[model samples]
Target: MENRKAIEAGQDITMQKEDFAALWKTIHLKVTDTYEVPPEILWVNGSTIGTLGNFSASTGKAKSKKTFNISAIVAAALKNDEVLKYSAYLPPNKRKILYVDTEQSKYHCHKVMERILRLAGLPTDKDRDDFVFIVLREQTPDKRKQIIGYMLENMPDVGLLIIDGIRDLMYDINSPSESTDLINLLMRWSSGYNLHIHTVLHLNKGDDNTRGHIGTELNNKAETVLQITKSQQDGNISEVKAMHIRDREFDPFAFRINDNALPEIVDGYVFQQPKQDRNFPLTELTEQQHRKALENGFGKQVVQGYSNVIAALKQGYASIGYERGRNVLVSLNKFLVNKRMIVKEGKGYRYNPDFHY
Candidate 1:
């Protein structure tokens, strides 16, 4: 005890401000002239600046379209070199993909990868060698460390770190204390190494909140945040909205899911009614006739995301995102824009004068 006390007192654990300044200067000099710090590969073209430096968040209920879209963008950045010239995009290229699959099946993942790669126009290659899969069948803390450390050493140049579900990666997802430590650990390693990390998290039931304490930290630290929702018509189609929620200077955009490719922007929605004319027969026409003869068309059941489309433009203003209860407005193509008895104002169209309320 006497020796320990003496040793503790003699230890110089505390550093002076001058020491830190000297260390910072030395590091800065090394970084400035020789060392190159790679930038975060933006999944969306021209979205990197708008998305800030990081993207991390929880999607609203029934939304995954955002995830799909972002993933596609990542794939494109990794495989297509041409996209980088115009957009601040980073494609992993030949760099390896580190996939930590907790809940997703191998089959599902394969399909998603195939579609994304094909869309990016990647040639066929060996899946086993290209991407490394770390399934959570019986993952232990020690095992995780071993895997991560080995990969970092053996394939230190890896570009992407994809963990399917955040909860499964940790032994205790409920413990805020423990989760905080884990988040710090990852952040330290990622910042030190400049690796891009992407993970999936489950949202609370009936709430927009994400699951567990770890999720909160992840959402706070991530450079990008996206929410995904499926279309009502078939639930097969999904919509993903990407937002720089964590970064203040960035804007958000929405993308629709693709069956074969990464999701793309789905122009917008239209409101139309059948056109009625005094010269036509007075008798009420059949459903088909009513739809065609009258300029006003019956409101179609928003198949998948038709409602969100409405919600996107509820503000009646042409802009991006919600501004004072004014939802983001997206204009449909000329053929799809609602034209039945609706007022038109520089991209802002309302019901036409002849149409009844």
Candidate 2:
């Protein structure tokens, strides 16, 4: 009512042409010649995983070694070396990489830092100026985003940004609106800063897919998506495959946790063997069949052994299950070797598909 009375009293309430033009000038305009292809910073299996001005994602089940694999990538970027036999090209004139952990505790985050440094061949005694690690486990979603934005804007030397727990930045992972907003923010940050942003996500337990709408949106927006899975034959080993890529598909690779607590690519690792008509399709078995197979004597023995190896890898000997499991696995491996069902390979044993367990 007061605004109406003011207008009636001849107040100037209309947008002026000069004011409108000033606002219009804020929009950036560029010619076609000014545009160029985004530079690829990280490559895996002939596919580009990290490209400047774009985003990528890595997802897997809990304790599937998603973070561990990412640590290897970060190490490669820092050292300007190859990761999993793929070249990691550093951004021009940039030597910094920022890693943000929003889920792990301070001690765990410190362990991650140590692992990255060790894998990158850096001495732990001296502080690193090129790599920045931030832990925001106690921060709210809003505060975390604020801090990330501030860092991206201020840290001009940081060419790569890693979000270890991307779900922490969203209020609800299943909300489509929230997922959309989160992806938009990520795109903006990647393009505005002209850097690569890699995010880690959790997968749904019941199936080999990411959690919710957030995962769907991320898969769509990401230029590359890497899926990490625990090996059924050897729980200590994790297989990483490029699930989606903007370019050509990359071959899969496998890695295992070394004694130094760093992920090392398994030597002469074969992801899968050639299909033979006589060989049973163990990899293509149904869920029910998988469960039933684990219930039988040999299957049960092998499964229990793998479980113990996984436990030892994750929790060490703190649990009696690890020791018991390892003993059972050793016995079972020997029996399988005698039967020719499994053969010893580089650092581990490989299952023979020709023989049914």
lDDT of 2: 0.75
Off by over 4 Å in 1: 1-40, 43-45, 49-67, 81-88, 91-94, 125-130, 231-237, 243-264, 269-357
Please write out the lDDT profile of model 1 over residues 204-319, one tens digit for every residue: 77654456677556655556656565554445555444422322322333445556455655555221332443332323324333233223322322213445434423432223
Instruction: Give the top-scoring candidate (lDDT).
Output: 2
**How many steric overlaps does candidate 1 have?**
39
Q: List the residue pairs that clash in candidate 2.
A: none
Candidate 2 positional error at 252, Å? 0.1
For all candidates, the clash counts are: 39, 0
Could you estimate the TM-score for every candidate?
Answer: 0.56, 0.69
